[model samples]
Target: QLTGISLSGDQKQKPADLEKELDKLQTEFDEIENQIRAGSPRYAALTGAQPLTLAETQQKVLDDGTVLLEYSLGNDTSYAFAVTQSGVSLFKLPPRSNIDKLATDFRAQLIPPKLQRRIVGIDVVAEQQRGLGLVEGPSENLTAFVASSNALYRAAVEPASNSFGDKRLLVVADGALNYIPFEALVRSTDGADYASLSYLIKSNEIVYAPSASVVAAIRQSGNKPSGKNLLAVADPIFSSDDSRVKGKAGVPAPAEARGLGLGLESAVNDVAGEPTAAGGLRLARLVGTRVEAEEIGKIAKSNGSQADLWIDLNASEDNLRSRDVTNYRIIHVATHGLLDAERPQFTGVVLSLVGNKDNDGFLRTDEIFNLRLGAPLVMLSACETGLGKEKRGEGVIGLTRAFMYAGAPTVGVSLWSVADKSTADLMADFYRRLLGPASSNSASVAMRAAQLGLISGKKYSAPFYWAPFVIVGDWR
Candidate 1:
């Protein structure tokens, strides 16, 4: 009941009443959990939500050449459990504070400070003009990123290096470590250029899960193959002033005024100024996503598969739900992604806001749970789609988990705010390999191949361009 309330974005209850009810329910739940713990030592272990035991995880979740690295951060010290089919090894790590700082520094290197700055209440037009070249270019602080990456590797992976030996990794991160993309971690700097660094991805294929139990659950659920190849949703109409909107009577929002705000209006204001007198938050149109969706559709069709595309005004919340999305083998959403750390329920993917009486543009996390997706892979090709509120044991509660619950065996999400062109390019390469003829590569393998391609390319060789995207849930 508490979870239902928390996840329901369209609840009619008043805020005060809801808060009180949630408080009461949480207290009752805690008391009941305590009683169950007291009654039997094994009762907690038997609960649906509890993590699977090491033996159970090894038997059910792991394959012959796969290993799980589950980290638990503590105040004084942190620990990692390297779980393999044959045995489990534990490694100690630095305190949570140390890891936190390193993760923050690393993210700073990837996301430009201009992009991170809050745009709310500011003159969006002026800000956009001043920051005309706000793209995430090569960082002058490359050494800083390298140092942080190496340090994180030393703290997190070095202690357990011997145990990992040529095995694919299933990372279950905790707290700040959840934000760190393990693939970006440098194994050795070794007189390497930005493009030629010895990243972890170069050697091992990696996937992520909120918990080992999640891995077991998703794998157990399996995927119901859909007859259709793809359902691509992109290029939402965020503002009525958009030139594409026929017969609308206002000046088109400037390209500079247009920015990706996900759906959190307070977090990022894409419009030129404050909300209109009628109180509507204007979001920037994602022109790149249109190209992205079209390219992917072409790829699917070229592979002799049927692809359904919802773009421009057709990309509405109503269309998304009405289309029976579960019939597609792969579901791709290329749009703005909002993350509300304080309120995970608010985190969502933004679609077309126009002509949708049933919903606002945002498709909240809880709302995603309601979707009946049967696709083996669901790719959220947007900024920061991988992030969510971190729970010590359960992992990051965000879009990845929502998609898993909705029936996707595998999900692709990004760790940081990414530039449009780079994201489109990376995603195009990914789908081409995944759906190509005679392709036996799993989702993780395909993602790795795409990232490697970017690393080898002269245009987007920086880790920032490719490392943010990761595969979660079942890799196979």
Candidate 2:
């Protein structure tokens, strides 16, 4: 079976060779499936619901003033399918290699290089200096990023511009393109400063989906009404030396550890252990998240909704699993997110490590699949929560998919390591817009508004701060 194919590429093959091999394997699998169907009439029943065809998807999933841009990265030449209610238009895109390089360069500019550290065997400095370049005015990083963004727009979106009038976009990106935030792409470089540049977000609301079939399924299973409004978990205490910990242990504090109440843009630290090791990992404290969560809870309450806030010791894996978290309309977790590319199952959101025998701090992807989340939205306000191992046709097999399977209609995730205070500020504005009076009450709309607000502000006007967060799945 194709499942046996090592996605890790232990023996790397050229793109052309890989495509040929996949095609050959798929043909054999199809013949075997045909034989099975001929042998037993019950084969169809065993296969569950088949994927929706283009016509079915157009009728059932898409609406007027909405366009679905789906891309398939190929060996020789990539293709983009612009699916609207009117018709499906095909556009030629750059080859996989070209798109991959552009996407990598674009992401690098948005997320600065990580600082090398020997103690935790992790990169720390980059997180501390995330949005420094854009703040200092038209640095090399900003210029390079704008160039890359515009190039990507030409390669990915501009070709299909005619098919996409003034409409909401449902993007299905493949391979490396999955990491590129579509909303951040510049329409055309007008020599405007970073803050005033014409971003795609300014014109259209965008939402991402793994596939058309997934979109149909999510829309079919509409959001269930929840008793509580918001359940926010944040500010997990990682070190025993933390002042919040009553009995201070003698373990050394994390390197370059700063004061707890430092401002938002202060250096945020990550706790790392040997890739194979578990337990005794010391994550730097996220003091800004405490304020972030509290402010969100207050907003929910003022908007006439019940809000539950969990912080410090209370924000543990035990509490996450034990509590009736499914009862809330929105579940916001603000903490560290660890991405395990080699082992996607290990990709998890870090909560308070202080727990009982079975509880470790990590809420790994496999564990998230077991969660019963009925919330309309689940926001993982942490570093690289949107990233995961890429499976050929399965989109990103990471935290987003796990939550979707667990019953969240929509999810908000970060593409890169986000600034602490800027993220908090963005989330506060997002929640206010989401729950406020005269609100559209749509996740996609609120996200766009929040990002626009950040761009207009002086503090976090850079794409690094506002562009990382994207809404996936049901826009409403």
Candidate 3:
């Protein structure tokens, strides 16, 4: 869509106005996502045939700051190396063309061999022995980590890009991490347009924080030890907060919907000055965060129906498992969600704390299904709950689906990392219009009102306003 316009240095044309300037900026990112996705199919053409081969690879960060990857490139072939999606590769890969024609098998190893490691995640099922599947390293490289931490996050986002043709905010986790990459985690929130990115870091909120049960499942797969790369958030950013976002929180907060709308406009609607390209639009307005119950009440108030709103702020790893959610009319969790093509169960939500004490913890989707949710709706306001291992009977198996299967009629879930500041606004306004005194509106009507609240910028409206909340299923 980008025709590579030539700017006139002679009499430089500034944007006609503010909207024009923003449109220019928005189109730039729009083109980037489009270009990458458009280029995916061509990768297969750059293939070289190889005989039976089982490839071994390693990823390393050199002293000079260059990420070095060493891999076996049979006798005669010109191959370029690319880092895999995970920041945990201990090996290198040949040029995408050379390996495109060969079949491969990928198995993870425990205890990284080197300190400066590259590549954190990979999918083994898509192995193509004869150019059937494209190599994983033919995409984006993430150099998103603090220099102080001495950890560099390198990823080949091509696989995920190819898997789901739709544009998404792909989050790849490092096995079991002692510290979540808080810095890298925050950068992508303004996928498109979000209000005051700084405000989000300050608020530290999210639609869903993973449940302990789901986090445990992700851990059992390959995300244990607080060092391995196991979490990845790949979801979409819908720039509107539908007030009737069917979740717990009985006494909906009293706030207008302007904040979230503004957030979405800044995150998704603004273009910084680029022309709208042909085809669909894609921006990175997702908000991603990690909050535990101890920090924000995990267990709902009262074990019965009235308990969904105020979860026990004291709910920690010790209480996540024994908790039963069958009585509520709606369920809302601020947790994590993962999609593992190799292991769906390994794909789960991360709880706020890790330890057994009232320290927040992870939860699995399996447990979400087990809940006797008498509630008609649920909200897994966490990252990637809508995404899951692409399988047949399994369908979409993250927390959202788990609750749906467990008998919840409808649910509201996010497709990517959401902006915290926007999330607070989305939640507050959604509840205000849906369950608050203005309970006489339909889902769509409530959503429009939320959008209006964002654009209007009333007391509660913010740029991160409308883009974080999404309506899932039929919220009639």
Candidate 4:
């Protein structure tokens, strides 16, 4: 029987290796079960070590001026654990239903009807291309958004802000709370509007860790001190029928543009169906993302690091699986992502789905845990990529946790479906701050700066454009 298994290698085990290990474990467990049925007392359950106490955790993980706010949700109530360098304390929260209602209303307000689903009709392409596709910020919805945000902030933070005051906050959100952007929350009790003095981003630098234990493990390992620059895969050509498949000058017209007669691009309405003949998971063409990728590549190269930029047909799951991606300091996957809430295991980031390359196309949630990534940061620029099915004590079971278990210290993900052009603008600003001369600031600080930039912009000032992206895991 294998007693010790460690997933710490720079190169993570491939899916084949993981499957073999599972099979071997099942065989060993069967033998143990047979002995136990025969009245053998040798098959006792293994008892793990106790978790670190607040004080113990502090000495080990909390840096000066940094505080940890961990939330635990119940059917009717919630609890928060606030840990600082001085010590730790627990606080009470509003009912779970209240928080849930607030989050639901908040999301519905942010995501526009046009952007709600994948556009299928070329007829709507003209409409979508117009500003109508951009999320509109009516004054009433903005007021409600601020009100909902204020309610959440008052519930989650006011109880502990005396101790948490002015410190860089590291939040460990639970359940529906994960969908709430703590930074976007209105400042406590300030009568002023979000445009003026009430936004939380104006007050504190915040980042999120999956759990307190994760922080301890990260601080303890401190491995991968320095890493190679980046591996950026964007603008994947998902179908063999795509005009770009033949290396035409520009992106050949998508199915709708080519007048394929199918009104909308074939979206995966039912996961049970077989792969379509077109040979790729069909999605709207993300025209702005090509520039997003090129800009980041240029930035990484200027920093004396050769970032491997895989675009169009080359950005396949096969390319990702074949490479030892742990070497990079950053892994930027800018593409469409899907969440199968009914079947969490099926949730994954969509890569080049139907290319000529031998590839499974989908990088599912299960496969992500098998990766041994050493990058400090992994950015997922897709809608609702941060979400997952909720389970008590476990937190949101999604891609964010998968990456952390696979060894990334930080992940940048979106809470809702984001506008493509706005994402490009925010990311370009974010990387510039994270990699430019002002990089002395932590990830969350840099993130706030980027968000503020978008908030202040004349054209893209709506919170819907910039507020969805949140940095999960370590800010430092």
Best-fitting candidate, measured by lDDT? 1
Sequence-dependent TM-score of model 4: 0.78
Ranking by lDDT: 1, 2, 4, 3
lDDT of 1 by residue, 349-395 (tens): 87876656555556777677668876658999876889887755557
Write candidate 2's Cα lDDT for 1-476 as tens digits. Answer: 43323222134445467446646765775676567546642223212225688998799779997899999999899999999887999999989999898888777666655411211112222232222211232234667778988988888889998888679999989988898798888888775567888789988899998777776776666655354479899987665556787664542332113222111111122223222112222456777789999999999999888989899878888788777877788999998777665456557877775532345556777678678877558998987788877876567778898888778878999887677778889999999999997665688889999999999995678787899899988776
Give residue 321's lDDT in candidate 4 (0 to 100): 75
Candidate 2 lDDT: 0.72
Q: Considering summed lDDT, which 10 consecutive residues are worst modelled in model 4?
A: 40-49
What does candidate 3 score on TM?
Answer: 0.35
Best by TM-score: 1
Q: Using Cα atoms with residue i matched to residue i, what is each candidate's TM-score against the true structure?
A: 0.83, 0.80, 0.35, 0.78
lDDT of each: 0.73, 0.72, 0.32, 0.65
Q: State the lDDT at 195 in candidate 4.
A: 55
- Error (Å) of candidate 3 at residue 151 is 38
- Model 4, range 316-435, lDDT digits (tens) per residue? 777787777767888888876766554455577767655524434667665786677775588888656787777655567788877776777778888766666778889988888877
| 372-460 per-residue lDDT for model 3 (tens digits) | 54445556665445545433222233555565545554566654343344455555455456544425543334544665556456432
Show the colliding residue pairs in model 4: 120-264, 279-354
**Candidate 1 accuracy as TM-score:** 0.83
TM-score, structure 2 vs. true: 0.80
Backbone collisions counted per model: 0, 1, 121, 2
- Candidate 1 vs candidate 4: the lDDT winner is 1
